[model samples]
Target: MFVQTSPGQSGSAHVVVLGNEKGGSGKSTVAMHVAVALLQAGQRVATIDLDCRQQSFTRYINNRSAWARRTGLHLELPVHRCTEPGETMQILDNESSELGQFLNAVSAVERAFDFIVIDTPGSDTYLMRLAHAMADTLVTPINDSFLDFDVLGTVDPMTYSVTGESHYAKMLRDARRKRRQLDGASTDWIVVRNRISALESRNKQLVAEGLNELSLRLGFRSIDGFAEREVYREFYPRGLTALDDLDEALGTGPGAEHVTAQEEVTSLLRQLKLPIDERGRRRAANRAEWFNQVNKPLDVHDILGAPQTGFQAGDRPGPRS
Candidate 1:
């Protein structure tokens, strides 16, 4: 409902793409959370789900819409769309169909919204590559496990040092090269470690070290993202994220995990350095105060009964010319 027409020079929305080669890496979760956070922060945001086969982000938005209608909150929601290619047998035709549809989607919403959060499929497809090139910010969420680390870099088992770039990392390099050549814009890529264990492990340390070295080498920022908490999944049915009003929706103030979820998101947003309005800033302050007043030691059982949120790891940035 708050969608506005605010096309800058190029008449395009600042595209934020959630990308990862491996499934279950939390791309859809991050996209939804960031989009919702921006909406709450008074930004005219839109969303596009290019994961045509799965449509994970699209489904999540639909859930949010249905929940809002049921509750009569009139919560601000972004205009969202899902784009998939035509069922053309020929490779050329399929590619063309996808390119045309993606371009049409961008044209329809770019000038009308401030941000376009795109959730890409796990595989390397034409649409995925195209979206990557258009991105102003590309957020890649990976788990703490080395299996997930395989998607980014090959870490030496002995020294725990990065041996070489992995396949997905190479793909990103190509995307960045193409992006720079086309628009003279550097895609601000940030790698976030998602679903980290509650307790530290030696493997987690090694993965962090690998990511640190890779961040230096590949020109991306890395940081700690969301924790492995059941509360995240509990919010699914309501289509509510940590950014939403918990007391009204859930019949109670945020619990400890909920509070932590809020902090994780707030910190993540600040780290992204996205453009935020004055009202957004004010709401952020109020949210902090409200959470502080309700912040208390929570039992695990109670925390489980409550909820919600995802990505944006406000970490120390390292990219510079």
Candidate 2:
């Protein structure tokens, strides 16, 4: 039995872990977007990159900070931390060291932030399992092809039906079970079909069917993720997300593709159903109210504070001499 020594159950932050055993599944991209989206929504969000070697998540955040500095745009950034890989020769010693680092990082921000977005490496590791066990919401982004789906389950060649659970799926089951025993909390696992093609095809239908079947058995929700979009690739260099103000970031009007991409991202966030603070909900409500009143005539009391002195509603102040 893998005992959790650290105070993993005491934190208040909802930990969101992005886990996919296979590479090129868009885990880092999804993690980045989730963190930024939460931050934009008036939530205190922090990010942890457990992939010490690849560090794609870390680099993406660094790129965002650098772009913000160069362009002088106020880009929302998370309190980010990257765990250092162990250097010792002994496997157990290295595991202990790495575990300590991971726990320390979580403990530091778990109470302070509203959400902690963790990007795990492609391959399974001790740290990866640890992160999964601690996740409040686990997001697994798999490419649309069966090659990517193999990580979750094997499909029958004759009928293209899901046959059995895969290694990654089995690992998740164990982690979730352990988590339940430790804290009596269930991890909300979501499988996302990422980089999906725009056109419908026979293969696409088969994959969806397979996902639906597997999700029923595993108790996971499957959702359509970001479509294959060139705009996503363009956003990488500048550390931008579909949720960001594209017009200001790109210095031009956003196109139809950008709009669609933004819609996809927004839809995904809604499907995740992550918890939002009361303040966040109020802020969103206020924002919608403001937009609803954008075209309405402003009242003098609302605009000029009850007509202060000579100021009236819609009054334009004279330029200073």
Candidate 3:
């Protein structure tokens, strides 16, 4: 556990919300590991479980707590379960006052955490929309399948050989509109194609091309994201492979799994550009001191109030000439 910082100066309150209407898309799993990865890089991270129905992220955190007790890893991160208003057992509306309360609490926390990762429910509810509204970076994880592609964008080349629209494009437009009216914050939308295969397939190529084309046209960026692998699923059981022993960091072949778990985490950090550096000969703490500094978003106050000077005949106050 790390020390918390005072409010208004949260050392790491950057919020990254993971959202996708489709379930079983590794939303919770990705959220859990991403938070842990940040923690491994020595960041004081916190989580918000917007999926009030299942509270999957909360469950994962509980499992982690149990593991900590048994292994003495002492891993702990604050997981806030949102309480829906009206005392009814229904999905909370993100647009409701209750959702605002959650965001308010996030902002009002006196102690500063390094990162805030939100795990949204697996549906297109008002809460999901609210998560999108609050996200600085919205990560959409989808499996590498045609069904998932449809969620990201349109595929009817024949219907509109001219004007092609996609689900992802519409989502981006909606998010942009909300930002203008409410948050006034820019979003970095990343479409993650999860559960990809190692082998090269024509179908895979088509999906990749579609994603690339859509990203180029719609102003979204796509990374390798996560590939299909057992390690991710295994996390549900052991609460993710520990950072002390990672042999499959390189590969899972005969000698490919020689890398340590720490190395695997470092690899992930490098991939996400989260600022984790390799250790030197000495096993000095490889924790990053400027983790938050690297990914800091422009302060709206600074941007809006920045002074821009245009020289004019009497632009500056001076004695009458």
Question: Per-residue lDDT of 1-321 in model 3, one digit per residue for the tens?
Answer: 222222222243567788887788878877887776655544445677777678778788777657556664434344344545435465454346567756665764314444678898877766678778777667788898877877767775643211355554577678767876884656777777777787999778878888887787676667655665555555565464434233332233322332333344344434444322222101113212222345432221111111222211222221111
Best-to-worst TM-score order:
2, 1, 3
Q: What TM-score fits each model?
A: 0.82, 0.84, 0.69
Maximum-TM-score candidate: 2
Q: Kindly list the per-residue Cα lDDT of model 2 for residues 53-131, writing each as its tens digit.
A: 8998999999987887787765777777888888888989888888888888887777766789999999989999999
Q: lDDT at 158 for candidate 3? A: 46
Q: After superposition, which runs of candidate 2 have C-alpha atoms over 4 Å from their true positions?
A: 1-11, 281-321
How big is the positional error of residue 246 in model 2, measured in Å on the Cα after superposition? 1.7
Global CA lDDT computed for model 1: 0.75
Q: On TM-score, who's better, 2 or 3?
A: 2
As a TM-score, model 3 comes out at 0.69
lDDT of each: 0.75, 0.81, 0.58
The residue-by-residue lDDT of candidate 1 on 23-111, one tens digit each, is 99988888888987776664557788888789878888888768777876544466677877579789898778777877887877676
Candidate 2: residue pairs that collide? none
